[model samples]
Target: MNWSWLGPPMDVRPLFPVERGAFLDLLNTLTAEDWERATVCPGWAVRDIAGHVLHDQVRRLSADRDGHPGPAFEPGEALPGYLARTNEDFVRTARQLSPRLLVGLLDRLGQELDAMWAGRDLHAPAGLDVSWADPGAPAPTWLDVAREYTEYWVHQQQIRDAVGRPGADGPRLLRPVIDAFLRALPHTLRDAAAAPGTAVTVTVPGPAGGRWTAVRGAERWGLAPAVPDGGRAAAEVELAADTLWRLASRGIEPAVARTRARLRGDEALTGAVLDIVSIIR
Candidate 1:
């Protein structure tokens, strides 16, 4: 189905609010037993994933208004270790509350976040970095929001898949999620020493699908609409929509996605792209 909205904002900042509503709608239809269903997140059940989603919104809301309640980590702990410990702690704590309590808290905060972004200038200098990309380097605020939207959208999909409920697969919703995840592609190949102007193309073939090229620049690789006229792509990778999401999110094994992906030209570059992940470990 064509999920296009009337002149949907291409900025992607508007996506989080819409996706949150869609997820809430799905949650409303679930039974108490449904909340206990196992999700693709391995150990996390439906309620656990929902609680994680709630944790994300709550932290985002707090960051916007007050300050982030920094994670409880021991001395000598790195961010990755700290995040894993804290997220587990958050989920465990959330499990104490009923599903209704989790849903209600998310609902109230999602709206507050929606209003906060609606008026914010996306081009303003952002203190946040897409950590995986140039760690500690400031990134565009729009990119930051795009990353958040992808996270929100994907976790919800995990819940949907567990419950046998399909969602956000239409052109409009699926496209943005794909686009946002690909933003990490350039960053993923940062260490791969490709010649300047070498390009890599990723195509997801479907009605909602589009092709994107990542061209190596003097300093880094960046995304573009297409390779320059007569420019041959250094590598090309093709994947199905569903498989693409699983691969990009690290939800599936690389060996598994390779069975479904078609790669041409530089195998190494394509491998790097396939290994790209939007979320932190």
Candidate 2:
């Protein structure tokens, strides 16, 4: 079978500046009270989410634009633990800054990121691997940037959810987030045993929804955009776009999300899809 279709490059080049502008607009509208409200991220308030996004922006510019390396991991530090510690450290320290300063820095740094992204070749090797999606190799620049876009968007959504101001669920913003998260399917299903050519399909239904199928190869599973061979599969799952994103990001627990998922065919393959967590934590 031709495996080239797996994990196709998504050139979300124009989305960087647009997403940044929306993020800034969202942040500017928050009241001081809104900043203190709790979000879905456990023990993290709206202010912490804002601070986290700012850290993300700074880290990207430092690592990719300025060629500065990130902090070294402690000996025997796993990726998730190290990332969580660093993120919490940043958020804890960032509390000293006023909201106005945070917005101003984000506005300026976002412009820098937009400019840096505009000049890069999408097909070039990424500065960091999107380890959740494809740990075996460095991703293309497009996928890396798309993941960044999702980070900003997801944080913005958290803030919105906290403040009771819900916007930015449009297909343009959310569709890409869902698409990028689905890239984790192959890795999510890596341990599920299936014969060569066995297909597991996942479908998210809505304006921002799409279908992806992961086919068992000789040594691994490979994900492709569309279903294969008359849309048949050994397993298939249908879920809403909101559930899929939250499910893949650990924003919602597997048992809770499974309540929303409609499963058919093989139970094991469908269960594997439900267990997907696209982020490091």
Candidate 3:
């Protein structure tokens, strides 16, 4: 399917189909040589990343169908460690395949994921637990759906970055990914108590961007609309759209993003924002 990666990012709520199509279109354009090119992910070439994406989709789909957790990892394992090891194992298994075969798998698995999501409800409790969200607790169904789209978009962006393709910028595509990524922020700050009403506002600067304030409530921090109609933030972090997405996804270095970012207010809160990562490791 030939689709334009250009124009504004789409307003794809409960995002699917559109971004999935876009990812597939971009995947189709990768030349054999392009697939061999190195992406920002260390030790993973463009083709390996594609394999990783496909592997994740297939695994998640299978888990959903089984309606139970897959074989358990050791308890008390950190989220990033679990993801990195799991992803590495999957990528290693797919490493011997020809780029053509791997690409074909991406297409097939994408269709499977799309079909699996179609029959599912977006508002009910999702079947899986998002470890990043409350450490083994079940996240809301909408959050799970949002994370799925963000996964596809970010992986596709990695390929685009490797091959010098552009056009996933702006709010339509990024806003959802950014919002979904930020869901972990409250969890990240769950223990870092602030005064009852203190807040932290994360601002991504661009047309497809927004400001979200996470105010510390009695027991935890939670996200609210950016406009401080509620109260002033104790800390505000402003980063360009690209930088924030990259950092949140662990696609960029925290130090680097912080250097390029405009930080105001509380230092500790800003530090937590910098350390916020949606990806495992």
Predicted candidate 1 versus true structure: per-residue lDDT over 159-205, tens digit per residue: 99999999777887788888777777778888888988899998999
Best by lDDT: 2
The whole-model lDDT of each prediction reads 0.80, 0.85, 0.74
Candidate 3 runs further than 4 Å off: 1-14, 67-82, 226-230
Candidate 2 residue lDDT tens string, 160-191 = 88888888888988899999898888889999
For TM-score, candidate 1 versus 3, the one ahead is 1
RMSD of each: 4.9, 2.0, 6.3
Candidate order by lDDT, decreasing, is: 2, 1, 3
Q: Which consecutive 10 residues in model 2 have the weakest lDDT in total?
A: 1-10
TM-scores across all candidates?
0.91, 0.94, 0.85
Please give the lDDT score for candidate 2: 0.85
At residue 16, give the lDDT of candidate 3. Answer: 66
In model 1, how many backbone clashes occur? 0
